[model samples]
Target: MFSFSRSPYMTALFSFGVFLLFIFLQNTVIYTSLQTVFSTGGLCACKKCVMDLNDDDWFFMRFNPTVPALLNRRNSAMRSDVFTWWKGLQSDPKKANFSDVVDVLFSLFPDEEHHVVTDPNRCRTCAVVGNSGNILGSHYGQLIDSHNFVIRINKGPTKGYETDVGSKTTHRIMYPESAVDLDNSTHLVLLPFKIKDMLWLISVFTTKHVTSTYTRVRPSINAVREKVMIIHPAFIKYVYESWLRKHGSYPSTGFITLIFALHICDQVSVFGFGAKRDGNWHHYFDNSLAHFSRGLHRGDYESRTIHELLLMDKIALHKGV
Candidate 1:
């Protein structure tokens, strides 16, 4: 047997050295653990002990719910071209990048279509509904869930709205800016606004971190097999330019989301899109009524656009639709 004896001071020094090595080796774990740290550590780290947690910033961006990314890129050229708006600076995309965006009507979408490689088998019928809180207690929840796949956006909670809407939600769409944790097989609908979000999505999905700090209240990103659907920055710019020419501002978030839905769902029906009561847009959040409160009206412009969609057979009118 080997004899092992040491002074208390020497043992203490050895323990300290081992602890330091452990911290350095487990940096990723430390980084993720820091989310609940302010709430996790029970006490703040010393100024000298604090290390830069660059990953936290990136992880939080994953849950951003406002203005999320329903589209990815053909390549990085979309941004590069837009950034260098100079006439002569325009550069043609390589053949590979050319297919960055392709217009596909929702009616023709394939079940196993993956533009890059191969896509998974997904449901055929899909629906994306926007809740203005205008339909709270309207009992549309069940009706909303009647489709093969139901998609819900921000402020969509089925528990309370089940009576009116139906509780069948196939996918809950959102972004890091507007993400809310819910109990369902909700896909974190990433709608990237800035270049950073796109970069983060590219990195996260590709790196494939099994235990990413991206979320804890939720599990590591599932249903990501859908991959990033490339949306052309040009398309966004084109839509906005057209809108400015006609109206003045770009489509509201709900309408923008609706346009995206129109391109993805086969049969579409809209309920509670317009305000139940006029003028008071901020009704649900502001109104004093508890059970019968209808939420805010998005705006007249979006309603007009939605109406145009209705006329074109793109969407059905209100009432259990």
Candidate 2:
């Protein structure tokens, strides 16, 4: 039999070795899991890295949502191109806005020159987190927070639910009604549902003159002034026509935010979207089961589209636990 002595130094060294081994094993498992999801057919795994946006990735034109993508013929045909007053104000444009509420929109944001992407190939990764109740037990917080940009939607709460929804918010997508308070670091992305929504946003800082529209809204909001982003009406229409394929009159805030991720992020991971626990459409923050309108939006169709995007290697969708 081999004789062994238990010295304090030896004990300490052994413990340290064991700790190192544990860390190595943990990292290996994480790598393997990410590889399995991201590298399904020899796709480059580097896309999984959470790096900053660099110059080469400048293929993503920082969209100016203030103006329409197509200004001339397209705008005339579909007023939603710019969400101008010409569009049926009450019918599906959500709300109405007059033509006079213009020229001032540009003044509300940072200079257009500051909008271009300076860093490239930083391997930008973004996580678009939704409010699906399926995320309740999914410990996706750490994974979601690992990304360079974490985009949360509307009122998806991180408090008391950090395990499911990561306690970070680089961006939050909302309209006037669905708006929620944000940390000074978070970007308050306004998805204008109508003309009044745009006016209301500007009014928040300048006049505080426009408050209640279709519903009550904060005359002023708490957010980093420089970080505010408006979803271009043209982009919304593009999502409606190209991706959603006219499945609904308009895309849901969740779906629009997902498409937005595809534009700005090199690698996108989606979490807490779709239905949960017996095909019920419910929010993680609330227990109330809801349903999407077949006329307004085809939730079933959107789900299918998301699956297709996953297969095409466009995005990684975490269907949740």
C-alpha lDDT values of all predictions: 0.45, 0.69
Alpha-carbon error at 146 in model 2, in Å?
0.6
TM-score of each: 0.51, 0.72
Residue-wise C-alpha lDDT for candidate 2, range 194-287, written one tens digit per residue: 7788788788768888778766877877777677777666777777767776776778889889878866666799999988857787898888
Predicted structure 2, TM vs. truth = 0.72
Q: In model 2, what are the clashing residue pairs, if there are any?
A: 53-119, 54-119, 54-120, 55-119, 55-120, 56-120, 65-232
User: By lDDT, who's the top model here?
Assistant: 2
How far off is residue 6 in model 1, in Å? 99
Task: Name the weakest run of 10 consecutive residues (lDDT summed) in model 2.
Answer: 51-60
Judge candidate 2 at residue 72 and give its lDDT: 23
The C-alpha local distance difference test score for the whole of candidate 2 amounts to 0.69
